[model samples]
Target: MNSSVITPIGKILNARDLGKLVRDLREKQGATQADLANFAQTGQRFIVDLEGGKATVRFDKVLQVLNILGVELTATRRK
Candidate 1:
C-alpha cells in the first residue's frame, strides 16, 4: 500500500466527500460493508449510513472504521 496515495485526502470539505473516500478505500481493499462493520465492531447499518453521508455519525466509530480500513487521521496547521 502506498502511503502517499492514502495519506493525502485532498479537499474533504464535507461529509459526502468523506463518505466517498471511505467507499473508495473500502472497494480498493476488496471489502464489503459487512466485513468492514464486523472488523470495526459496528453495525452494518452504521457502515451504510456512514457511506451514505449521514450527518450525525459518531466520530469515535468513524475512527474505528478508519482504523479497520488501515487509514489514520492527521492534523496539521494550514500552510
Candidate 2:
C-alpha cells in the first residue's frame, strides 16, 4: 500500500483546512493527484476540486480519499 501515516490537522474550522491537510498528506506520501484518485477509485477532477476546497463535494468521496491516504476522521464534544 502507498498509505502514509496521517498527522494531526489540529482544529479544522473550514473546508480549506481539511483540503490543506489532505494535500499535505498526499504530498508527504509523494503521491500524484491521479495516483490518489485511482487508489481511492475516484476521478482526477474530484481530487483537484477536493484539494481546491470545493465546499459541495460528496462526503462519501471525501471519505474514500481520506481512507486511501490513511486518514481517520474523529469527532468529540467540543470542550
> lDDT tens digits, residues 1-78, model 1?
764665576666678887888999999999999999999999999999999998889999999998988778876687
Clashing residue pairs found in predicted model 2:
none
The TM-score between candidate 1 and the true structure equals 0.84
| Superposed model 2: Cα runs more than 4 Å off | 1-7
Expressed as tens digits, the lDDT of each residue in 1-79 for candidate 2 is 5356455667777788888888999999999999999999999999998999889889999999998997788876888
In Å, residue 35's CA in model 1 sits off its true spot by 0.6
Question: Given candidate 1, what's the lDDT at residue 70?
Answer: 74
